[model samples]
Target: MSDASALRKVMAPTGVLRATINVGNPVLAGLDVEHQPFGVSVDLATLIAHRLEVELELQVVASAGEAVDVVSREEADMGFFALDPRRGESIEFTAPYVFIEGCYLVREDSPITAQEEVDRLGQRIVVGKGSAYDLYLSRTIEQAELVRAPTSPKVVAFFREHQLDIAAGVKQQLEVGIEEFGGMRLLPGHFMTIQQAMGVPKGRSPEAAAFLSAFIEEVKAQGEVARLLEKHGIKGASVAPSA
Candidate 1:
């Protein structure tokens, strides 16, 4: 092997560097153009694979719950999705890469237009099972009667079909839903901030952690991550260093 290849192998961990991220538009922060999954998270994973000179596998789970399962079961070497502190004990996070805000989506004709409306009177808030918004509603809006969808797309469809009074999703996700389906509007405020991170399986090898940290640092320092985010018109996101 070439010296560079040899050095890479030395730094690389044994086995495949598999990764799974959502396939949704704006999959990473707000970086979806042409309704594609060209988000910053996708760019970071692809870049890491290139630098490590290792195979990169990308998997798309239908929902966030499945993404969590991918890492927990060792089916994926890493998972890139929104972070929940409750999940930290089950997996190791490589520092947050992006931050997201959650909001409620409603039909344009719906009476729920503002955050206060959601707090006081919102009735049916559709959300995916195990999604951040589902958890948030369960805590904050006890009377809201949260409806569960199996995937983000189904959540959007629930609202469009008038089966739900509202759907909760990230700001960008709601935007994508509106553009794709053409009849929804965002409620006036946010429920909470969602931090996005790369997660390694619990008790992962040290070499795996080293490679992820190094890959993230290089992507941040070289501006590759930023460039990809910009290419997709994502604004207001910055890479957080791995802790």
Candidate 2:
């Protein structure tokens, strides 16, 4: 069988390229006025379907964990999310196509003026549950207290309600939501850069994963990724280096 045919079989077995879209990560995906998924992830999912010559089916979910779960269970063909050691165990990630800065936000009057300052014992940090920042900080943070929010869009709200020391999330997410939070300013430096990639469930055909990875590189080289980011007015997310 042709390589194209095999990829189609492995990636779109139901005759549709089913892609999980996470609207919880507002920088990547969000619900519009009518609450429909719209953002960078949606465009990438459509591109994958067009490349495969199949119907595009978006499986919209509220969180990255939900999106990854769909892919792991084979309920969706693939998903777009961050690449982390824990998630990599169950999914095969392609070359990252976007770099999102993860940073901490503190009240304007707060003494913490830098990223590293938040790591001290007794300081409280709130992060979205199951988010890339949450997973990373959970493992590496040894002194600071950690808290959870339902999603990235709500991290700031959680921080304010609990009167926490800092809130961690995608830089753009905090920027967009912080105006409602009076006197809140982002720390001068970021804690980490979330490497965002397209991935398929582990144990799927490697041929399909290879095709998707090559597609990411082609789009990055051809400027499609940059165009998409600009079109969405997405800031703080730089195009990632080719893998």
Candidate 3:
């Protein structure tokens, strides 16, 4: 086949690439999953599929842990989750695409107003099971009793229902919960720095990796990255070159 024909074949929309979405946060990278079919991570994945001439098939899953296993086991093509160094060995990360800091959610009238104050003795903190916040809390806040909820909303609910003293999550999520559930407050200080990235199964086809790299670069070059961030009202996030 001619190079042009080969390119056409590769870029043709074969079908939607199977994708998984975490049910927790709707707005990521300024793209509200509710408004736009694509969030920051989904947009990144869609761009990759489009460039490769394939369609994107998004699948919503319950937790990041499930997303990780689905992609690693080759059940799905890719996953948009907070990429960490430890998971790097099991999956291929495109690059550090975005950054979000961790924060605490508490009752609006509660005494916990700041992250430092949350560290005081007898404070109980809740976080989603197997999430970045859980890992951070495990390492840093030794004094507070840690309760693990299955999902982000549940973490907030655990605190709201008085099952726990505090809940930990991203700023956007904490804000949304404070509004949705009522009587919740987002703490001032963040838990730690977090970086989001795209991942696929280890040893997946070279075609997929090449497509991911090119798609990420294309979005950055086209300024879609910045636009998505502002569109979603998600601040403190920047789309960087893929590593």
Candidate 4:
């Protein structure tokens, strides 16, 4: 089959490219005033669909884990996610198109004043279950316990409700949480930098995965990624360097 034909067959088998939009990652996606998904991820999905000559269908979900599930199960053609080894089991990710920070937030009166201080006994770090940070912390944290919030947007609320020692997630999200919840302060500096990429379910045509990687590099080189970040008013995240 021709390259175009193969790409279409693998990426839009149903004649529409279904892209999973994880609205829980506010830095990449969120609902607008009308509750329609709109953000950098949404725009990139549109671009990919247009390039494939197919209709675009956004499968919006409330959390990163749900997004991963939809894409991994092939219910969606593609998704945006942070680079994590556990998730790579079923998803083939492009080099990151964006980079975001994973940070820690704590109550002002709490004694956890430094990033290193978080990984101590009796400190419970609240994270969105199945999120990239959750997966990372699960594998790396040896002492502190993890309390899972239902979603990233709820991490702060979960932390507050449980009086957890730390709330962990996107720095931008944590900043918003501090404003909404009050009495919380982010530990100076972030713990990890999340590499955000577009990915397809494994077993799709290799040509399709190659196309996604090329698309990411092209957008980054052309400044389309930067434009999207600015257009969405996203702060504290930068376009990933070309792969």
Find the candidate with the highest lDDT and give its number. Answer: 4
The positional error of residue 181 in candidate 1, measured at the CA in angstroms, is 3.4
TM-score of the candidate numbered 2?
Answer: 0.96
Candidate 3 vs candidate 4: the TM-score winner is 4
- Residues forming the 10-long window of minimal summed lDDT in candidate 1: 24-33
lDDT of 2 by residue, 169-209 (tens): 99988887677767899988788999999999898989778
Model 2 whole-model lDDT (C-alpha atoms): 0.89
Order of models, best TM-score first: 4, 2, 3, 1
Candidate 1 vs 2: which has more TM-score: 2
How far residue 173's Cα lies from its native spot in candidate 4, in Å, is 0.5
By summed lDDT, the worst window of 10 consecutive residues in model 3 runs over 4-13
Worst 10 residues of 2 by lDDT: 173-182
**Model 2: CA > 4 A from native:** none
Candidates in order have lDDT scores of 0.70, 0.89, 0.70, 0.93
Report the lDDT of model 1 for residue 24. Answer: 47
- Greater TM-score among 1 and 3 belongs to 3
lDDT of 3 by residue, 150-191 (tens): 776577777767657888887777777778878777777777
TM-score of 1: 0.80
For candidate 4, the 10 contiguous residues with the lowest summed lDDT are 1-10
